[model samples]
Target chain A: MAFGEFDLIETYFTHRLPQRDDVTVGIGDDGAVASVPEKSDLVVVTDTMVQGVHFDQDTPARAIGHKIVAVNLSDLAAMGAEPAWISLALTLPEINDEWLTGFAHGLREICEYYNCQLIGGDTTQGPLSITVTAHGFVPNGKAIRRSGAKPGDWLYVSGTLGDAGLALAARQHRQKLNPDYERRLTERLYFPSARVALGQSLRGIASSAIDVSDGLLADVGHILKASHVGARISVDELPLSLAVTESLSAEQAITYALTSGDDYELLFTVPEAQRGLFDTVTAHSPSKPVCIGRITNEPELVQLRFGDEAWELPEGLAGFEHFRKTELSQ
Target chain B: MAFGEFDLIETYFTHRLPQRDDVTVGIGDDGAVASVPEKSDLVVVTDTMVQGVHFDQDTPARAIGHKIVAVNLSDLAAMGAEPAWISLALTLPEINDEWLTGFAHGLREICEYYNCQLIGGDTTQGPLSITVTAHGFVPNGKAIRRSGAKPGDWLYVSGTLGDAGLALAARQHRQKLNPDYERRLTERLYFPSARVALGQSLRGIASSAIDVSDGLLADVGHILKASHVGARISVDELPLSLAVTESLSAEQAITYALTSGDDYELLFTVPEAQRGLFDTVTAHSPSKPVCIGRITNEPELVQLRFGDEAWELPEGLAGFEHFRKTELSQ
Candidate 1:
């Protein structure tokens, strides 16, 4: 079978969708119609995953689907929003039923888990890539924007940071790990969960928030620039998974923890006044938010401390700039 | 100068946007936040354009950008929704500053003309493709859906059709056109306007509506299936421009009109009772909607008539199924 656009969509996408009353009209229409509560703000975010750039062409179709949705959901998570809907634009080199089945399976898992509906989308023939635009809602006047962080705020990160980076290094043959460690690390890289609950819990508590897709220093630095404040992050306090620690040297692990991308964790700030009560409000989340540093008055300055030594990023490393062709991996 | 994602976006996409009160937060954040009108429903649509599939790689970046936004706006028009915001996901093989400038110029022109804001997006390295998700608003319970066409509804189509299809045929050298005719037809191809006002004007007047992206027959066929009714289109009543008529034989022009994709016109149905006041209600529109056909009781049957000789579409002509690698153009 040729598996045309409509056929593929009907077979995989139109299967029993968990109905939502808010979705007034869905798939077959020119556009999808939905409703948001009267006083809530609609939050929209888009992310694209390209073959060979964001992921290797040989990666499993399921992981590719999961990572694309996960990364976009992370953006929603950063805004302290509750993800409600998504639109996917999938471009493929050719039609493969098996590939699509795996892709749909992974995609549905995330969509159902987040209670987000795939409202509408486009599927086309081209180099394989996925661009997912996620829509969510945040209570009016309560979205945790990156610009709201203030000086003297306590900086924290949810979940672990370097497991994804270690996985990437292993895939590149920059390091080696046992199978069990490798499996765990690669799973972290491929299926990293979005801190949706953590983000929702932090609302009205965290001063500002952002997802850690592009390493700790880089992602945290975005907060510095947006809020016109600086940060002194304690590298020794940066959290790492056991798999990452067991697989690489302390120096290498630190590098991965500080500079690795695609972790999809939330990095946010809370004022000193809210520190004592942060745990009480955030206890609903499975991932513990770890305090790593403090926001400083020095604007745009990010000072890294590793115990007694003031740390510096290796020369030429500046996070994951998607357009910097050569340094995309770093 | 190499245009990284942030730099290219900051330079082009982040230009001075016209202020929209509904948009609480503009671009540059992890997620863009906006508010929809209270008591109104939100409408969302997404479309993707890929190189060599949707347009030639040599096509100007500006036209590609314009067509992407235009096509998405047409989707919103089909739903009788008010365009509000858009999120773009752009993938390119490499950074070309000239291309980015031209692309942004075209994108901004449409967004400004429509009063839509470019809120958030992602840029990545890959085969060239543009996916735009448009957000709009419709009054509660007032969105004109495809399923609303009734057996007694009189059919109407906005603007002319086939110019874009004729242009596509001209590009492939399947038909030759004079330079003046070619210029006009190609411009029609590249810059077909979405019938936003016409659709909005038809709010309480038209029974059902849809945008003609996949030719008149194929697109209207969708309405037939949705409304569970039939249609008899008068081929003689189908509108065509001088450029299209001059570029092809009468028979060929009819084929192109019925099968050509990318024409962003609206095909709608209006019941007989509303016919008396339809003109008065739609007076605000500059492009007068034309009476084209009538709905029938025989569901899923679309009978096309050229004068009196009932026309049958040639075997195996399914319009613009992006999959079916060989059938994309047909």
Candidate 2:
């Protein structure tokens, strides 16, 4: 290792961006000092990625860093908020210059891409883990939420799903994937794009929004539970990549789409009356949202459909529980 | 081990406090939505504690929880900021309800004590670790900075020091501590209070301030480096608890006071011209400040005094290096 904590931060992490008027002080202090815009509500979210649990020990440092920030940003996107600042807490078993550089590079890429500033953080020695807490700004009382979905709302999902789950299976050798499919799937798994622009466009149009981290079925379930409504989702309408559709059978693709995790796509609901507004807003968005279902008055009841036929999901395939085991999870 | 992530949070973490108007939204969302006071800058800080590295795995979950929040709050205190909100990222080996409840109790105590709300966070399964990011508000351009120390400033420290490090040493069997001393020291280690009130009071009075987490010598050294000045600290004036002074020799007490980590007390410097104001302000404080030294023009040169004799610290005793191993570190 070529650096201690202070030196490591100085060399690889400090002053990546030019000084900004909103930042009073950054780095090298008890805490960072920054200003929030007047009258804007701040959106705060955090996520932790642990070695052996969230990522393999041998995963490239760049991918590890990119995915951690991406996941947190995905949460902000689900709230219809724009990124502002982030704090990172990193625990590592050792200091490696190569790894640090790669991780910093990946983090910088996302920060630049979103124009978010790195404000404060902590670093310590332990089993490898990364915790990032992100802050964003949204117009007061205008942020999208899961509790706002009404019975007549239409459920929508941004971008594709199932590729990340399939990618993990292929890497674990549980599924045989063609070389091209494997490469594309792996990249999609590591660098899932957070749909910030689409989320912003849906601020007033979408009734409720949430990121699909724990598979479409489970995350959509959160919106239902929070909104006190039911959902009827067509499994055939689940967005899937070319690789997922080509590599897996119809049943396999549906299973991955429903039960697999780490997709990081936005799952939102649009009120029936505002469907036209939602369509017009998303039409200009970089990533278009695909409508998959409609909310119902029957609470806690989720109906799944494949074509015109109703499908029954097997028990225990309802996405991951942090404290419980879920088979074939990302 | 009976609960999933969502269940554990709902039972042990949510609704710990009454609804506040400032909190537009709280737990059970994509991200928390909070309103920051107008024209105030946010103080952001994060700290991570890992089991067996920062604390013993056998340590009580209550103390573990309190100390993690305490450490991060101390950082805010050092910046002369008022606590606003915090986000916790927790990674654990299992979901033992007993542990969760104890941890929650401890955390809630500090959150209530500081009037800071838990906004949002993530919980995952992994080696035990906790990361807390705190946000606070400081009036525009009024926050204290380490770089503000000037020559001829009187340096002062709030509360006592060295008990925590001595306690750690005793626990390691390096010293056979008296039972009472051991208990007091251990309590200080686990639940050290942040000098928030004192820090806030010193906002305009003190030239520079820093929290003594990594021992007075090292932390003061940071203020000196940042301010481009040196210090002459009287070692004889180092504060100690009754138990520490009686149980340890002068040299041992001084060693611990200079090198101990986790004190969480504030060390600040007031300009010579403001000495009267400093004394007047602190005399009314619940915890009075003790003047220990003076800032000098000699850059990077720290002089330690013990009455008529100048003292040199023993080598390799300069506080903590998180990435590097120190023999007596937690």
Model 2 chain B worst lDDT window (10 residues): B321-330
The deviation in Å at residue A302 for candidate 1 is 1.2
Root-mean-square deviation (CA) per prediction: 3.0, 3.2
lDDT of 1 by residue, A1-330 (tens): 112556567778878555678999988888999999878999999999988888886788899888888998899999999999989888888878789898998898888888889898988888888999999999998888998888899999989988887888789888787577888888998898998888888889999999998778778877888899999899889888888787777777788888778888999999989987897887766789888999999998888899878986655554333334444322
Q: What TM-score does structure 1 among the candidates reach?
A: 0.95
Each prediction's total of clashing residue pairs, residues at least 3 apart in sequence or on different chains, is 0, 0
TM-score for model 2? 0.95
State how far residue B128 of model 2 sits from its true place (Å). 0.7
Model 1 interface RMSD, one decimal: 4.3
